[model samples]
Target: MVKLATVPVSQVAGIGAQKVKELESFGIRSVLDLLEYFPFRYEDYRLRELSEVKDGEKVTVAGTIYSEAVYQRYGKKSRTSCRVMIDSTLVTAVWFNRPYLKDKLTPGIEIQLTGKWDMKRLQVTVSESEFPGNGGPAQSGTVQPVYSVGGTLTQKWMRKSITQALKQFGEIIEEVIPEFIMKSNHFMPRKEAIRIIHTPADTAEGKQARRRLVYEELFLFQLKLQAFRTLNRSRADGLVHGYDNEELRAFIQSLPFELTEAQKKVIAEIIRDLRQPYCMNRLLQGDVGAGKTIVAAVALFAAVKSGYQGALMVPTEILAEQHSRSLQKLFEPFGVQVGLLTGSVTAARRRDTLASLQMGLIDIIIGTHALIQEDVYYRNLGLVVTDEQHRFGVNQRSILRRKGMNPDVLTMTATPIPRTLAISAFGDMDVSTIRELPKGRKPIETYWVKHDKLERVLTFIRKEVSQGRQAYVICPLIEESDKLEYQNTLDVHAQMQHAFPDLKVGLLHGRMPSGEKDETMRLFSTGETHLLVSTTVIEVGVDVPNATLMVIYDAERFGLSQLHQLRGRVGRGAHQSYCILMADPKSEVGKERMKVMTETNDGFEIARRDLELRGPGDFFGTKQSGIPDFRLADLSVDFEVLEQARDDTAELVAQEDFWTAAPYVALRHYLQREQIFQGELMD
Candidate 1:
């Protein structure tokens, strides 16, 4: 059979070069692409008897023209009105600006009229007409597909082009999924499903077609993930790490606070992954300030005890420095050496750290992208931990992993993602979530206030600072913009400085140099700066325990998850922290966001709501997070199907003959041709 995927759209009867260009604008280059461009909606234009129609009902009825259609013009406007008989009931049909329709609506000619019915006048305001006697397209009694079109492409033209393509190459729309799997799931054939989706007989058939398509899309996606898992395991020379040691136990017992049950469970899961013969590919996600650092410390400690060095990579220099200090404090008593390597490190210090790392002197090293530099090398690197994993690309992670001999990887994220998103986005990685916050941690008090309450908010901030606690004043922008009315960091910094002459106000934003930003954060972290006015550069990995107040201007402009992250920067200490959302939102969505922020502090719940409001594209950003932007499957609604596909693909890949079996030959061919694995597992 011919490969439908390679068959160009130009092979269709009506698609010329110009039409092909237009179709190409929508990313539809091949027959398979055109076929998969499913309609967003369908119009039920099936004909109904006049007796079944109700007042103001949009109905399609067939009738014979009983009266001569008269065309009349009133200066600029024209109307063609006529009488039609449907089963002995006469109804007036009116068409506006259709002077040419008068010639076609001849007496005794059978016609189909679709429009809204006015029961009082016994009239139909005709929007469309089909002369059944003249062999018009059978559109009167069919559910018509409506394509999202642009650039001179009409619905009629799209339908014609698609219909031509189906006619020419419908037989070659090969079954990508194995026949056995399809039969066991009671799924329809691929060819039939494609045909039914384009031209479904009824709504039920359309739903069935959608079911098959959705499942196929998710199944293919999970297949790639499964293949990656298989490929990664096959290529790995995994090391079995010894985690049950006196040092690890002493480290845990020496902590100031007890670990949460969730944290303990996740730590156990990580240990199990470490002891496995295969490399560990795990995602450790928790809410902000959920003691993820301790869990990670446990993992790093385990790796170090196994006579191997550990590597912890973060996204920002500040986070790297922060992690280095924390890890040094935790490992200092155990005589474990922790090194910090960043772009800003002194030349001599960098050289010393490099020499130490190469000589197995550094037990655990923390840094930003500098960790993946060509000059840096680790001796016997066994475990890799990445903080804020989404900030790094797959290649970056791969580079860091390659530095070691297939070191066990544990990726951590402060963003608490919902299970559905986690499953879809990080399907290849084993996920361990820590939902519980640390014991003795106080929930941040959040409030949404209007502009009038600014004075009160400032007074509250002043009071908090007077008590020897720092506060964060967050703005949406760095500089004031004429287009946007939101507060900016510089302006707010000046205002706060003027408002409190005795207190020091430090300003920070993305536009500042790295040194300046680091210095400003240092002042805030050390309590030298009474109030820090900044943009979202401090959104992640800024741990200031003394800061008890968070004032976000124009809070509605931020997503729920972002607001939650910003709120998390505070509430780290024992004092009751507070988050002030000073927003007078204009849109309902903005208002709802503010409401959600004020209502709850659960990051997972906020993530779910954010997904619903802004969709999956903007959640973690499809491009940045490597989440596939599926055409037919919605991660929000099709989560169950996603899970089922995940399970099915896992089972299928577990079979020894999955790659070479006769049933999977077509599937493998399609996968290779599409290059859906992003070249990661292509070999």
Candidate 2:
């Protein structure tokens, strides 16, 4: 493998200062980075003829210009037009805002045109038009890779940079995967794959390279994740919280509603972990409407029954308070004392709660990250339950784990993570999934509406409010931005207040003070507010069963899974709930995303589709969401590889002398380097 430091822009002979800067913008500063910067797309222009060119199809054609160019100027704008005859067929080419193109394209001059053709206009608006002698169709036709570029970095410059970098480093690009794995998978050789990917001689070559590369990326990522899991399971201090039959039976009988088969299965798994001699690091993943909270309650009860205290940590104060209230309701019958601790809690209340917790006066403590505070000491803390676990980092969970004598951890998330992602991101933990929703609950009615239909939507919301039903209006941003035209939480709140003066509209966003957020959430949940205008802060754990409408502004800005989660906030009660996705109809991506939300209520399906459509980066965003930043692996495409990698890593680690293996040494070093880099980044 080429060392990252040895690869520099100057090594690419043709790279100048400006070109180097452009490459740097795409995070390509070294030869290794350049080689690893895979193509976002490829233009397979191997076959094309004017006669065979389908309308609206992107194709490449080489021909001589047979007619004089025409130029027209309308006000400040100018248009250039020309006709090219190829294979006994004539196609018009038009260029907007480039009148100089008319002079450049003289009649009888051989040129190559590549662009989407519009049959209705008989035009091929060339994305790229070049003279036949200067790198014409033949040169461009060879596997043309396309990089995602900003407006400042033109396609020509990107192509030139890649070409130069490949010329210098192509021969030196190293293959890391073992030869056996490559051969078993029927993958092309690394050097040939790189060459074909960048400059494929034909469409088939490009496809083959893409297939191999995508698989490789996924396979490596899975291997790394599996390795991490194997190492963790081996080293973690296992403390079995011996089971108490009396407490388990009492906890189950105390519930008002019967446990669903899925919930029962998950509870059994948790109990099994608690009884085992090994440390219980378990991930309880469930859909939004699924009864994960109740299962957690039962687990907490079980811990308390075994004479151990449990702490439940939530991401938001609203969720903390909600958990405290719900748990109080459930545990009250069993004489369990539940205390709430949040940043907003009064000093006196916090001091009293801390005193009670230390004295074993409080059996179950429900709080935010405040539960992890150094000043807070648990009397006999044994179980640490983290709700919406993705919102917390590994270190945060670890801190909680250290509070007791190797406490058992039960992390939970309403976001239904795919098996591959769950294994990689939470591979250290045993996983249990709650796949079923409650019996009486009905699926929400979802809709995708154009922004122009907002007036009607508002009218519908007013009608719902008149019927004593509440609604939630969610925005992507907290405040109105000069950069984007989409409505924000503050803007929407103000607009709603102005439009409906009698309606109680409240705004809640991440920027608000913790106390204020709690108050706003409380009002919305208790029917004090008819409408709650908020950002995605209410995406998880804010349950308002009375609310019946969920209107999302700029719905396209959110992933399908996230939108589904937001939709889950409503539709909790008996009345039918509606999710109105207000999006820009002009954007194809936006429309498609909203369509997914409208078509499906299955969180798993939405998550799978979201991963496939946006990839992991866009789905999680820059905040990382507690998932490690993967350089090469794509969770969507590499799921199968991840499973295989996990199995292999587990088996290898189970070997008598696995740690001393040569490949293991290198892998360990790589992981250590990645951890250090990640720590620096997080800092």
Candidate 3:
């Protein structure tokens, strides 16, 4: 009858200093953390009828040992095999590389063995087994929690540790959600939900437990986002631009081609926001070939036309340079002086640029985060545009905004985030989508190829190079690692060089110095390097239109969104482009993902498919994407729950008495804690 309460792991029984240290490595340092450490999957080992077992089926079988356990050693490895008779049927139980298990598997012991049954080998090679007197298989057909433990921490040890901790400290864990909310949501009691999740009597109970926990997680996250929106909306002052100049239209007309309908719509939205009384916080999202850059340029031009300076911030120097060049070409004709600020600029050049910026000689400034330095000052700064906006956190953007008087902020991303996530992350901002590619652009011809087809792909790249075209060879890793299965950029570059020594091949990765990266990218962009091997650093904002061939090694290792972005780097011009996804065809997941990329060029459609295939947490690299990470709820699966929570929180906040509510108080505390945690993590 112990009450369940959240507490530090130190308060748990049997968790000494050494165990606590080990747990911390896995981001677990408290009872609350341990309790929230939900299982990735469950092992249903409650069934025990030998006759019910089918070939290649996973099940649990209970029987008495019928023969002596046989131990065989091969080199340093050993395996224990024994015959167990259940209901007069013989089944083999085998343990690999566990020589000590031979002594434990004594004959005539009444034990339960759980694993996949290989009928062809007449084996039930035990993945898990336990004795009756101990914490054996809980029950037949029951769902058993399976925690993600380190290689050194066995499944049995994890279960034992958590069970012991729960027994001693479960009573002290207080439920965060109120009883009223629970009832309204039809959620089970917190304690009961935890118990059922850890030791469910059946699959149905497990599903119910999961539903309750997932809902709670989604609800809380959505509520927090809604509260943030309410707070910001109340405090932030809106900026109003008086002038409606034709500068944006002039810039658009100066371009070689006309803007598409989708691009035009996005530009209109930006113009509307810019001219509004309130400050504009907007996100411009488009697919790879979508004309997002042009839309952003139009917004910057609008700010300049209003007689105010504008700043464009990018994540890397290469992208900053690219943006600077593109903007310079577009703005110079209109007498707009665009300046580039990056870490690699010479001291004299930087001084001149900064002086010009301070003197209002520069109309638009494009650079990396270096633009946010304390020494960098702007004259009449009225607007800020960020590329790959997620690269900069909230604090970074806040600092940039402090440079101006509530500047109209416009952010752009090539990755098309689903609307639900956009609302959750940027609820206070207006969103604009550029859904159409520019006219005369061709979709990249995509294909899924096996490793054996590398020769063919290389031959195709060589042909493209011979025809005066550029190509890109991308890898997931920078250097070879013993842990990861993906290919490294360096190794792939070397191999490709060996295969085609005559072609100008260059290598680029995050590990390279700023100067080297810039040089390599410049070489590729200028067509000096025919084949560029790189890492994901090229995943955003690097435009090389003539580069018609893209070869991604270990394409399976990349998320679908990222893979799409990388593919976007090509097919930007009139010529036909091809994207080759090189992967292992034998892997079902890899094959299916690559096929999805091959079949569709639509970013939104691919995003949905990616979410459906790999869930929310895995779809866009959420953990590393700098968005809020969830424990129990999946943003992809709990989309409906999120929508409901958002609506409910919005309604509650609209009420005058919201601040007096107990739930509001608890939510404020939770948000403060989350903010601190996020700060520490980012640091």
Q: Which candidate leads the pack in TM-score?
A: 1
lDDT of 3 by residue, 383-411 (tens): 88988776776677778888987788898
Ranking 2 against 3 by TM-score, winner: 2
Residue-by-residue lDDT tens digits, candidate 1, 1-683: 78777888888887889989998999999988998889988888898888898899999998899999889999999999999998689999999999988898899889999999999999999998899858787798899999999888999988888888888888778887777689888999988998998899888899899989999999998898887787667754689997656768888999877999999999999998888878888999999899898898999999998899999998888788888887898899988899999988989999999999999999999999999999999999999999888778878888998899878889898878888888888888889999999888988989999978989999999899989999999999989799998988888999999999999999988888778888988888888999999999888888999999999999988988889989999999999999999999999999999988889889888888888888777787446676787888888888898998998998988888988878788777766766654534211
Candidate 3 deviation (Cα RMSD): 5.2
lDDT-superior candidate, 1 or 2: 1
Model 3 scores a C-alpha lDDT of: 0.80
Shift in Å, residue 589, candidate 1: 2.3
Regions of model 1 farther than 4 Å from truth: 47-137, 231-236, 466-468, 657-660, 670-683
Candidate 3: list runs displaced more than 4 Å.
1-34, 64-84, 93-111, 127-142, 148-175, 178-184, 245-255, 276-279, 391-398, 419-429, 448-547, 551-563, 581-593, 608-624, 672-683
TM-scores, each model vs. reference: 0.88, 0.81, 0.80
Q: Against the correct fold, how does model 1 do in TM-score?
A: 0.88
- Tens-place lDDT per residue, model 2, 187-221, is 88877787777777776777788777766665555
